[model samples]
Target: MNFLYPGFLFALLAIAIPIVIHLFNFRKFKKVYFSNVQFLKEAKEQNSSRDKLQHLLVLACRILAVMFLVFAFARPYIPLETGADPDKGNLISVYIDNSYSMETVNKEGNLLDEAKRKAKEIANAYQLNDQFQLLTNDFEGKHQRKLNKEAFIQMLEELKISPASRTMQQVVNRLQQEGDSRKNHLVYLLSDFQQNFVGTEKIKSDSSIRYSFISLKANALPNIAVDSVWSLSPVHQPKQAEQLVVQLHNYGAEDAADIPLKLTINQQQKAISNLNVPAGKSVKDTLSFGGLEKGWQKGVLSIKDFPITFDDELNFSFRVNSEMKVLTISGDPTQQFLKSLFAADPYFKLREMAEANINYSTFPEYSLIVLNGLKQPSSGLAQQLKSYVQNGGSLVIFPDLDAGAAVYTPFLTALSLPVVQELKTGKPVSSSIELKDPLFKDVFDQIPANMDLPIVNRYFSYLERNTAGKESILQLPLSQSLFARYPAGAGKIYLSASTLRPEDGNLSRHPVFVPLLFKVAFSSAKEQPMYYTAGKDDLLEQQKTSVSANQSLVLKSTDGTEIIPEIRQTPGKTLLYIADQLKKPGFYDLKRTDSVLAVLAFNDNRRESDMRYARDQNLKDLFAGQQISVHNSEKDALSLNIEAKNSSIELWKLCLILAVVFLAIEILLIRFFNKTKNIQKP
Candidate 1:
């Protein structure tokens, strides 16, 4: 229908030259053999016609050869049916859904193995040089894997189901960018087809895309899991030992049968609690480990039998500093709030003595100094408090709200606090705080109405203007009281500006009262103890430090006896645990020779049960509604969250082979036809 080179058309006009020669009549022949002359003369006209026709056949062959040569140079390709955007090439992308739903058990098998089998089959079907990239939900830095058949299959074999979760929105976005299906993209998704991964409407794709689903397995396994667990050192006593509470949820719809759960601490079995958790509910289990030493502690909770596990066991660890010593030097006998709120908790020690009776040199051992309404401190007291704060001590003040302007100006100013102004505000409004202050960040969401929390009932004076750096909080409803404060370099300080008494409506009686104070005035200032067991996120920061790329370090205990740390640095300054062989709970002596550099503790959070596979379609939940596919089925196995893509060799290479084979056939046919004709002539 089309000609690439129209110039070849001129060859037809050249055929006319033969016609012109014939019409001119320029030929003559001599008579030889009189007997044939009669036949020759009669056939002459017919022979002339036949000769011209023979010449035309040869011309037609030459014209056709030239036309084919030009057509090959132009190069043509026919378009195929339209669909998702034409893939970068002829890529049929298969996104396997290895989510937890694949964990279901049937007579055939689990869905994950089925997905893997299908991937291998697909990989085998594709050419040996095609490209493929696999995608999964458990994404780390290296999430993409593009390989030919063998390597791609190997990677799929290495994939294991993960307890971690991901979303379908993420999977779809990644697949669109990473898949190599440029030509005929056959997007195959194999999955259990959980409710979370299916959609009512067809997803939008470019012209050449088609989707196929392989619905595999489903099982309604009843599972109860310890979904989450949190352990917080009380804001009030950061260094003290306390109980850990775990939250358990039965993901199933009905009441959970009584399950026996055990708690283990440092290899010490604590308690075995059996309780029936109501269906679709959560229950909190508390584990109390008594009198733990300062540093890291780890605990574990295990249930004997469970259908689904990914979340059945939990790991929790926390660090505790040394005991908190508070030196409360106060002349006022009304130390009722401090005496009752802290010392009575039995976790803290209050060395309460009159201000004049205290020894100044003993300040180094205390974690906090409570200056209760003491307007002036001796120069020695000032020096002691100053040094204590420099070493990270907590300080709390009960300033005299009624004191005169110059009453404690010099002492306060030394801590970067402003001088007070007398008669600045006559009547301060009784109101709630405008905003929950950071010192009170924990209680910000816990505001309760109708709880008659006292306003800072009264203020005799106000801090001088422009003295606000970090020293003010809780603005007055009518601008009077400096309700709370934290002066720099003086450690953490909270000033009530009013007395804690019932006549002031006793706001301290509320549940938010003590915790807020503890978090603000002391929580953030907790100091690291001399020993620490390594945690999930642990690091050491030092200046100008080095060891032969690999070397050991040591640490000593209080008496300079225990030397711990039998570690040799590998490559970086960081060390990671590659195996589960954990050290027993005890003080460790680290050493390189007799020189002691640090003391350490060894403790591990036990892994109660080895069951890791999730029994649900968490992968579908993770990806939201991405299509997933699976092939071979296993009766039972953990859910696989990472789906592998089908891989095959390059299509262009196959196309080249076809062209080569066709050329060989064309040459063989020409040779055979000529040879056969010669044989027939014989």
Candidate 2:
């Protein structure tokens, strides 16, 4: 027993007041006449015994009232928990695991809902004298500090689960830093063991702290998932073939049954096939197209199952990349070199058309038309070339050894090129090339001039092409081997004084070979964009974990004391999600409606053995060694149960009770004493 106000023991000296008042309780004896003495003596002898009885009764009543008052002042109470904190104790760090998987339902239908109810009851049961610290998955700024009940609850409400993941080892690190080896501390973890959570075993630091792991998701339903799809082979080309190979997976407790699969492209059925895969294993199958046009396209793959979330369905798209059909308007074999390159590429379809002889509309379907060793382009061909360049087509020109300036003038002029300058007796030579340009990215950087092949010492003239209003990409060092060019409206032009024959030794291919034709040609090509399907497993190829969960399942229990799941993995010490651990007591769950086979973590639970629920031993041990026994004389120990304890209340109800008792005692004593007086009188 303990008194809340031990200082009230001083109220016991109050006994002295009643004792002194009773002993000297008197008015001055009034001096009276001598005749009064004789009558006074007779009355005194008769009522003397009665007066002594009244005096003794008054002394007993006064002492009893004083003792009761002292007891009331020293209020006493007994501790519910022996050795427990009536005032102070060690701090408890509660880490709540709030992750997505906690959303999973148990047989009760609500995992987090049940967890919160249990947690609050636990908290309320603990005495208010205990101090606590709250924690969550995000161990930053908030939840990382110590607080009282009101403050701790405020931080708890602010907690939310992130898309990121967490592990026990990461959380143990923070606790190890804050925990003192000399003092007692406990960490309570509450979370659902989603397929990705880290269990308690990986917490391997050699600290003397206690930990408890309350797993949130127990007895969850088995789930299935979509794994991946491989790229379609070009060899499977058919107007009716939309070939995309794919794989599916099941993560059930037991093997799953094979089910039929349907495919949809741009909202229409392209192909359907049944993929036979074993539980925890994946299977591959080819899906073909019904009939579809050429271009980039999108599609969906789906499956049916309860929870509707972890089923086999994903989003994907692929491009047909229509092949380019090109027409070479000349029957020149210099055509063979260029023809072979384009012919080998699947995207380019090359063919030789008749020379452009004034009629040009017959080639509208051709993406580009080339000229080699033919008459220079006429007005109609020049106009057609302008349209093709504007419409994003490419062209290559190789001049004849004796091709005159007048024949090629209209073509160059229509391309917005300067007038051509004739070469003098000496042949010019090319010194170097530009490697930074994209056209030279692959092989153009240092292609040696093909000067050894043909040496035309006296065959053609060189062009002194005008330099006004032009953007030159390459310059031939000497008067002999330079290729200078620029872009016009939607087309580009090149002026040269030599022919395509290796003998010219000054062609763009020889030294100008790099920047002259190839550089300009590479720039004119169009670009294509690529897309990878969502929910594909390859996105997780290098990832350490692969996980799936019910859309309705959350990862942390409410009141945050349950165990979060451990992900599958090869073992080691690692920190997941932001390297922070939540061991607080609260509810934690997940968001986002998409189901994905994501890689998660695996952890150890060696840390869970640390919790000991220590109590405050200071006061208990202090009293155990002392042999003191304090008490109230009216009874043994102090108790407010006495009716006198309520006597101090100024309320009329208490006053009425006292008034009735006081009058009854007084009247009965007076009546009995008067009867004694009558007997003495007779």
* Per-residue lDDT over 539-566 for candidate 2, one digit per residue giving the tens place of the 0 to 100 score: 2111223234642322333344323333
Clash numbers, per candidate: 54, 64
Which residue runs does candidate 2 get wrong by more than 4 Å? 1-93, 98-100, 125-163, 170-185, 194-196, 199-201, 204-209, 234-242, 258-260, 264-269, 275-277, 290-299, 308-312, 316-338, 344-682
TM-score of each: 0.52, 0.37
Backbone clash pairs in model 2 (N, Cα, C under 3 Å; residues 3+ apart or in different chains), count:
64
Model 1 has how many clashing residue pairs? 54
Decoy 2 TM-score against native: 0.37
lDDT of 1: 0.52
Minimal lDDT window, size 10, model 2: 534-543
| Window of ten residues with lowest summed lDDT in model 1 | 673-682
Runs off by more than 4 Å, candidate 1: 1-101, 138-145, 172-216, 231-243, 285-295, 319-322, 327-395, 400-458, 461-493, 499-682
